[model samples]
Target: MEEVIENKFIAIKSHINGAPIEFDFEVKTETISLSAKSKEVIVKNLYVSIDPYQLHRMKSCSSSQTTIYLAAPVQPGQSIDTYGVGRVVASGRPDFAKDDLVVGLLAWGEYTVVEEGRLLNKLDPMGLPLPYHVGPLGFSGLTAYAGFFEICKPKKGENVFVSAASGSVGSLVGQYAKLFGCHVVGCAGSQKKVDLLKEKLGFDDAFNYKDETDLNSALKRYFPNGIDIYFDNVGGEMLEAAVANMNKFGRVALCGVISEYTGGGKRPALEMLDVVYKRITIQGFLAADHTKNYGDFISTITDHLRTGKMQALCDISHGLESIPSAFVGLFRGDNIGKKIVQIAHE
Candidate 1:
């Protein structure tokens, strides 16, 4: 017998400009008609990631139009776009069954209906923590791995710098550089994050960027020999400073610019002539473009995380209702690590 469900949903009421988002809660009716379709799975969402990259997409841009060709845009009255982990409650696919766990793109809702191509491989929570799929083993870890090793091409004993150093990707990039035998330095907004970077994450040294108005002076003081590689997470005045202090032949991996996501702002004037004079290379990357290498990224990070060689920090909000607040927190610098919303208690 097929079941008809009246599902409660939390949707984005409208685009927001500040620290909190507007949401519309509604009930929608869905039937089991999807079961007739092959390779279809219906799941109950458990956790959703609150990431900075989503903010970049919220703004109006030509690139945004191209990126979400397959997905629906967030209309004035709609659910926000979010990636989450869910457990299959019903499956019409041979590969999945009742109670199967998977991680992939989903809306900020209690339940979702996914057809072929949207579903990801099943995950074993025993191999990794469930939320890690939202953090390390998922997007954050892969972003750090691909950005640091693939883009920056870090060398042993090189001097490495990471901005936003205590967040998900920045923290991993710093530690990954340390693991590669590099002299790693990092910058954070708070003393607590700075302390965590230095003492817990194995950063060689760290400082609070909030306290330093002159980023150039700060970089010069920290890297007296100049930075060999810069894993940039915040692209603004700090990026300008890092560029000014880059060593000859330095490499930079542009990961994310959380600082400029909220307001369409201009970065401080960069000395591009310096790039030519020093022969510096700066490259920007989206993690999805490097998905083919994700298996390698997962294996390596899983080992590190399992062995306690690497650590992931998170600022988790309690419910699906809190998704808006969690997303907004990223812009306010209120979250200490990866911002995640727990849709339902495990």
Candidate 2:
């Protein structure tokens, strides 16, 4: 017999132009079947990732909406699909079964009925916590791996810089840089985060960006020999400063511009003359586009995480109801690592 269930999901109240409040989100309920149709799997979401890029979709801000299907504008009243960990409640697919753990593009809801099991894959926890699969072991780790290694093409003994060093991607980038024999420095918003970067994450040095009056001077102080590689998460003045301090033939992997996400920061006037004269290379990269590297990324990171050679940094909130607050907290720089919302118990 098929069981019917009430699924509570978060939806936007309206298109938000700037910072989002809890009122901007409303929990909506819908009834769903526990039984799945052909090629479909019904999943109960356990944990979901909270990211800044979703804000761009909510604002209809990302130009990628026209090109990249993932950045399509999220309309009011639509349940958001995000990277998450879930358990199959029912399955009509040959590959999945009831109680099998899975991960991929689940929803910000209690229950998700993945038609055709699209973008979904069976997960092997590798004896690690499930939330680990959501953050450093998932998209965030992949993003850091792809951007730093593939886009930047790092070499050993390089002087690497990571902005938002305590963040999901940046933290991992710093760790990876260190493991790869690079001298890495990072910037964070608080002294606590700075401490975490330097003491715990193996960063060669770290500083509170909030304490620096001039980022250019700060970069010069940290990288007296000039920066060889930069993994940029916070764009704006930091990008400008990095450009000014980059070594000749330096590489920058522009992973994100979180500073400008909410339309709050000043537009950066990047000095093209510096870029040209320094013969530097800057490239923007997305993890999904670099899927070919996933096998190596997963194997390498899983080994490090299991051996304690790499840290799986995560900040998780409980309950589906906390989703809105968790999402809003990203902009406030409240989370020290990957912000995740746990919807249900495993």
Candidate 3:
């Protein structure tokens, strides 16, 4: 016999032009079948991640427009989907069963029905917190790993710089660079975040960008010999500063451009002559494109996390009702590490 369940989901109320607010989203209820269709699975969401990239999809972009990478514009009434971790409640696939933990693109809701193929990875529960899978072991962690190692091609004893240093991806990137024997410095939006980078995450040094009048001078102060590798999370001025301070043959992994996301048209003017003289290589990459390295990321980061070689920090809000505030908080710099909403606890 099939069981029926009433699910509450967060949906966009309308197209947003600027920063997202709490009223921009609405919670709606829908009834769903507990039994999944063939090749599908019903998951009870445990944790859902709120990322900055999703802000790009909240606008009313053209249907034919595909400028935003790995994301599509969310329709007014559509449920928002992002990275999350959940437990299987019912399955119609041979590989999945009830109570099995999984991680993937889950809706911002208490429950979701998804095809088995959409599963990113199954959770192992290796005595680690469930949220760790979505934080350090999930997309954010993978982004850090791939961006730092594969894109940056870091060398030992090199000087590394990270923008948005206290962010989920940038935080891990700084730690990873430090582990690779690099002298790392990061820039964050707040003093507390800067302290977290230097004191908690072991960054060689970090500064609050809000306190710095001249970003270029700040970068120069941090990287006296010039940066060998830059893991760029925020674009615009920070990127311009990093480019100006980059060493010859320096590598830059352009992970994201959060500064231009919301109606903020603040694009920084870069000095092209600096690029010419430095011979800098800047590469923009998406973690999804590097899915082939997922296994290696999991194993390497998992070991670091388990043995305390790495630290995973998460700013979590409780309940599905907090989803909107939590999602909006990312833009406000309200989170320290990974921003997550805990829908239900296992």
Candidate 4:
């Protein structure tokens, strides 16, 4: 007789419109029959990344609208959507086998059965940190690399500004700009993050956005000459201020607009006249669109990682049970770097 292991999962119990996530715990069987196992692999999840973008998808948006579908809404009572690293426990497929490590989309559970497309290329866990696959070398790293080099064509001696600068992607953006000889200025919500950006992350200048009552004045004070590149993460009022202070032919990488992700009410609007007057180019992008360049990105970033040229900071929460709180912390700006959940390995 084939041996089976019991599994436990945490799933969303209901849809939340404008608040912290709600979840329910359930126990279930880990393995399926032969036919089901043939198409899918059962994996023991190791770590889950807590990202601000996930909060945007947790809400139930009407599918009837075509103009606004940033992310697919999570079905009520289903497993929450996230990227995780796992070890394959059982596999009927030839490409993967038991004990193989993988990183890709996975449910927020101890064990999960998933079809193949979401799985990433098998990784060699030796000589590398596991959390880097989730942080600097993972999704956040890709976003920062692509946003800076691809979307925003930075020149030497350019003045660059990044919002939410101590978070996952922002810290890297600032560093990359500095490497290219651009003067980097960053804004964070708290004083601690500001210190991390300037003292630790090597930003030329940084400030607590929360402390600045007049955002436009703050931008002027920081970049009296005007910003040449803007890496926008928190969009809304700060974006508007960035636009008002941009130089001629400035570029803006619209990586994420976390400001509009929550609450059912009206989203904040931006003033677009600056795009015309300043000849500013603002482009929105997703990491999925840049997979072709992953090899190139990994080569450059990994080299930096090996040398002391680049550094990564991670804010990890322990256990699968802390998933909801880890996610909630992103909104409250409770995390210093990348927010991640560490599931125990048995």
Top-lDDT candidate index: 2
TM-scores, each model vs. reference = 0.92, 0.98, 0.96, 0.92
Best by TM-score: 2
Q: Which scores higher on TM-score, 2 or 4?
A: 2
Candidate 4 lDDT (Cα, whole model)?
0.80
Cα miss at 172, model 3 (Å)? 0.4
Per-residue C-alpha lDDT of model 2 across residues 21-129, encoded as one tens digit per residue: 8899999999998778888999999999999989878985667567676677899999899999999999889999999999999999999989872689999998999
Instruction: List pairs with backbone clashes in candidate 1.
Output: none
Q: For model 4, how does the per-residue alpha-carbon lDDT over 1-346 read when each residue is reduced to its tens digit?
A: 6666666666556565675643422322344433336668877788878887765555666332233333567665566657778888778678888889888777777776878665555777545678888888888999999999999999999999999998999988998999889999999998888988888889999999889999999999999999999999988888888988999999999998777667532353556777887789989988777888799988888888788787888888888778777777787788877887888662
Question: Which portions of model 3 miss their true places by more than 4 Å?
Answer: 62-69
lDDT, candidates in the order shown: 0.79, 0.92, 0.87, 0.80
Error of 3 at 21 (Å): 0.9
Pairs of colliding residues, candidate 3:
none
* Model 4: colliding residue pairs: none
Query: Could you give me the TM-score of model 2 versus the true structure?
Result: 0.98
Tens digit of lDDT per residue, candidate 3, span 31-131? 98987899988899999998988877888874323854458888887878888999999888888889999888889999988975575457787888989
Say which prediction, candidate 1 or candidate 2, comes out ahead on TM-score: 2
Higher-scoring candidate on lDDT, 1 or 2: 2
